[model samples]
Target: MATTTASVMGPHQKYAFEDTTSLLKDINRLPLFMTELDPTDGEGGSNLALEALQALAYEGTPFEIASNFKQQGNDCFSLKHFKDAAEYYGRAIAAILQNDKKKEETSGENSTDKAELAETDEHGSPLQIIDNCGPNADDDEAEKLKELVTTCYLNRAACNLELKNHRRVINDCAEVLKVQPRNAKAYYRSARACLAIDKIKEAQECVERGLDLEPQNSYFKNLAIKIMQREDYLLKVQQQNTQREFMRKHVVRI
Candidate 1:
């Protein structure tokens, strides 16, 4: 008895299939298909590129998009559009926050996977020989994100200062300082906001902190001078008022 393979095609049989390249060409002909995209033309193209970037922002990894938003915020700030700049910086901060959450989730998943691998094969595990005790990809990403977040906060603080939103300036500067304790711009911006709202002592403290961070910063030096002058003027005014009150109360028979 002769046995034959059951899954074989006969000699006269041929598989019916369309050409993949032709199919691809046909698909590309569709109006909605964007086979070719140019991102450097005419204010960065029309809605197509904009919509694509927006989709990427929603779907892609957060760092690049967040950085892009930061650059946009800087551009608006250069043009002195404080409110618009603040909005852009706010978007960058939101993206970074989302990115941090995603990283935490991924780290948790990786840790669980590592644990399960260890349990399943204690000797054969690759991690046994080469332990990665040093900084990892996630750690680098986290540091980069921290820098970006600090920059965004500082820029937002500048915008808030320009808008006369003193409380918001203080808040943003404080946020920056949380990530970058020696940031002179954060201290200076916070101090400026404090001075704006008549928190003289707080403003002085911020100035001193900034000066300690960057003693040669001309802006901080100028601000320190301004604060001192303002304080002197305030003291002079107080003394004049006190003298006027004394004369009024101790008036003799004149």
Candidate 2:
């Protein structure tokens, strides 16, 4: 004959129970998600967890992802892990290019403006102009992305230099020059890479450009002297070779 006692669970307890149930459901699905993200070949739980963390970290705006990779590249460079640093830098560059493509796709109407801005002076233009932003444009985000791309290229060039990847270094430096021709470091790095591969004339051009940008840079001055000496050495070797060829062709045999 007595009424049943009301259930003692509070609203908060009910919500907590629902949350726990939802979490359990998610946990059940996690293995499938992980497999899709990174199919493992019998890797341990720790490795799986690390892969999951990396996948999460990669979820962000393109610029954010690029910045993260660029920082990782800088850390590796500081540790003298040139190969790893170069890989990270390459990833950063890819992310930046992806961002650029997205912007171009979404803002096709602005293509004319971008083309006009791309016509700025190679050595004297401001970053805004180089980035296809008008000098008066107030788009801080575009400027930042441009700067990040430039830095990534420059840093990758440094990593290539350390790895003795002279051609890659020159290519990376050339990319930076395309965006920021006044970047003395880019010029210097290009010069160094050119000299490494015996591109004496190219090296001299880079050195001169760098000197134009940074007249007081002792590194550029020293590099200029080295390029000149290399040119002289090559000339002497060519002359000697020519003389030997002439003797071989014209001298009488005993």
Candidate 3:
């Protein structure tokens, strides 16, 4: 003879439970099971609970939430908080991926319904469409997500460079280039990372590619100069070491 009631997240509304084992169990599973919810209104109280949970995560759509995270990353980057910026960018990327996955699932379900409906259509079937579906479906949102993710990768690369994580910088820059082949900043960051590891030829190639994309980029030009200087310094050191070895081997005979 116990009663339990769920409450909305905001305000002083609290639920009282005497033996609410089922409700407590569901609340515990909210984080893991929320993503599995139908998102539509048919799934009883679970759907409503999922919506409230999502609203608590962010105040808008997935794209908007991802954009907000990206902006936060940029703000941290501007203040030179490289580690914090990387974390924010990571969250933004996760949000975008999660959004895309949900959209794909919804699209698949709609496509199945439409295919079934088309079988019984007298007038070529009334097209059943999801909110975002088809070839150009959410294309604008797709492009925005791509741009945001690319920017985040490039920004994270910059942070890695500042942190002297040269290998990670190279990897992040490579990721950006995968998304945006002609990104000058990606090439620039990759080139800088290559130089840090004494990858002269790779650095040169990166700089050349970057300069090919942006012929008048002062940053690329300066980096190219620095690479040339480092190469010269390395060559001089190598020659000195070779001479020292030769003298040590022959002078020992004398």
Using all chains and alpha carbons, the TM-scores for the candidates as numbered come to 0.61, 0.68, 0.62
Task: Encode model 1's per-residue lDDT on 184-248: one tens digit a residue.
Answer: 88899998999888788999999999888888999989988888888888889999999999999
Candidate 2 displacement at residue 60 in angstroms: 1.6
lDDT of each: 0.68, 0.70, 0.68
Which residue pairs collide, candidate 2?
none
- Which is the better candidate, 2 or 3, if ranked by TM-score? 2
* Model 2 accuracy (lDDT, Cα): 0.70
Write out the backbone clash pairs for model 3. none
Error of 3 at 35 (Å): 32
TM-score of 3: 0.62
Judged by lDDT against the true structure, how good is candidate 3? 0.68
RMSD of each: 17.8, 11.9, 13.2
Better of 1 and 2 by lDDT: 2
In the range 217-244, model 2's lDDT, one tens digit per residue, is: 9999999888889889999999999999
TM for candidate 2 is 0.68
Candidate 1 residue pairs that clash: none
- Candidate 1: C-alpha lDDT: 0.68
Positional deviation of 102 in candidate 1, in angstroms? Answer: 7.3
